[model samples]
Target: MVEALKIPTTLAELEALGEEVTLRIPASFEEYLEWVDKCEFTIEYFNNEIVIMGNASYYHEKLVAEIIFCLKTIFNKVTGFSVLGSNIKIHIADLISPTDFNADVSVVQGNPKFVTLPSGKKSNSKITNPVLVAEVTSKSTIAHDFGDKLLAYKKIESLQYAIFVSQYQPFVTVYERKGIHHWELRDYTRLEDSFVLMGQQLTLAEIYKDIQFEK
Candidate 1:
């Protein structure tokens, strides 16, 4: 009988291991991630590797739901806009072996009717050109959220805004594109504080609805 290998204990070691595994055969790993029999997990494909994500907490999900509700309500009054579920994969870079990242909630532009892109092409695999993207933070992902993912997201030509929400406390960070590859940042810590992205407003209080924090 063979025992499973223990995972690395520290972040640096784990990252090194992940790189080693990805360099071995990226296609095989990517295929397994998209397999139908795969378990329920929020997986991320970045830098030629798959990141297995754990289930979000109850509050985390609720916060996401509320934000979606707000987004839908706002888009309903507008034209050529819609929101996407977390399952939508986004090809942030080149289509060939592109790095796909799933936004918790994404705001896209489309006609009031269901959209059929150029030449009536449609896809469930991945999307690009989202104007706004939002992410709800978990304890393990704070650094990746602000560092690595932020860099990747800003590279999207059509991406004008990137927002990060905190589940552990009443906090939010809004990144607005300023110039070519330049982003201006703002942080909100008060419940009454709100962040505006793509002409939509989201208050911190509404995000933390029926939830409390240790801080």
Candidate 2:
């Protein structure tokens, strides 16, 4: 949490910071996190902080499963890429704790490689690059998903598309990359609206198949 301390210019300060830097984490922190049941609390590393995600509602989980099934049908038959679920974290930075994202589902071009962490240890808990990321909005996370997280997801150089599916309605937003840093936004709400995401096509109705909303 400590930020903006003047960079140590002296040898003594360098030695002091080296020892103090490792003190930031308890020795058992990683060990505990590894054994923690994600079903209880979805934990993610955001910048330098650990973010505990709120639980998904039944509807949210159902939508996630449906969308994952649709994506698998397309990518598995044509793309030959790995289509993974939420537990797969994608590293977005190389900071102290690092910024990693856990999307509802991700269609990746290939499996991620082991990356050496700031602590000189290799972490096997992330997908370094993904092609498309999707999020099923929840009441507690819609704000971050539509705001900061959307911006962060675009910053991933390998990312070509970002899809946001509504949990409370039959709407979906797809951001397609046009060129370097250029993106096109398309929202599909009507059943007739066809989503042309990364050259693949699907109707909004197809995504919301067999799902009922409160009247």
Compare the candidates by lDDT and give the number of the best one: 2
> Candidate 2, residues 1-215: lDDT per residue as tens digits?
12232323344543554321311122233532442333243455554544445446578888899999888876756665778899777777643545667899988787666556556888776766888999988666777788757877887888999999997788899998888879999888887788765567878777888877622
Residue pairs of candidate 1 with colliding backbone atoms: none
lDDT, candidates in the order shown = 0.68, 0.69
Off by over 4 Å in 2: 1-40, 94-97, 119-121
Looking at model 2, residue 169 earns an lDDT score of: 88
* Candidate 1, run of 10 with poorest lDDT: 1-10
The TM-score between candidate 2 and the true structure equals: 0.77
Q: Which regions of candidate 1 fall more than 4 Å away from where they truly are?
A: 1-39, 95-97, 111-122
lDDT of 1 by residue, 86-160 (tens): 887766654444566778898888621222333465655567778888898877666767876887898888888
Residue-level error in angstroms, candidate 1, position 188: 0.7
| Model 1 TM-score, all chains together | 0.75
